[model samples]
Target: MKPSHAIQGKTSEIKLLIESYGFVSPAIFGSTASGTDLDGSDLDILAIIPAGMRGKISLFDIQHLEAELEALTGVVVDFNVENSMPDHLRPPIEREKVML
Candidate 1:
């Protein structure tokens, strides 16, 4: 099912931002993809970040990106580095993944 128009637009903006950062195979999951979002629902993103870029991303860098996405999308964002995610976390995200 398609997400609401507002969320869809925000997701698009987020995808563009992630793309600009050169992260590949960005996917969104959780409430954003499930269409069960409430007023406080946050956006969940999984990205296949390059190994070279991996070392460059820190808590601070991730925080900065999160802030940028929130500003651009008006939604709280939870960003996940696909390679770093635990095996258990992979299943649910994969099941509902919306690859951008």
Candidate 2:
């Protein structure tokens, strides 16, 4: 399959996978969401975990999850912790992120 935007068909599958791994509110952003993705661009994923479940989802765990997503989507996946992102990134992320 070719690279795609943050449409429901693509996002829904990723959303299910993310939730299964205990991540909450999964979303996609950057060029994919902005409708300018190139063949080489990676998928930008922004997500957070429930406060109560944070301990179970460590950085390593998220990295593994990101690998899974990359494999499934056939695109490099860049997973980001929503709360940890820089303040300056919030606006662009808000403007670009598509809810999954």
> Which candidate has the highest lDDT of all?
2
lDDT of 1 at 76: 79
lDDT of 1 at 10: 64
How do the residues 18-94 of candidate 1 rate in per-residue lDDT, one tens digit apiece?
86776778887888788787776777888977976877667777778878877776767788888889998888888
TM-score of 1: 0.83
* Model 1 bad stretches (over 4 Å): 1-5, 10-12
Model 2 lDDT, residue 27, Cα:
87
Candidate 2, residues 1-100, lDDT tens digits: the string is 3357333366678889899988789988888888888877888889887887867888888889989898788878899988688999899899889887
Candidate 1 overall lDDT versus native = 0.76
Q: On a 0 to 100 scale, what is the lDDT of residue 79 in model 2?
A: 93
Worst 10 residues of 2 by lDDT: 1-10
Q: lDDT of each structure? A: 0.76, 0.81
TM-score each candidate: 0.83, 0.88
Question: What is the clash count for each candidate, in the order shown?
Answer: 0, 0
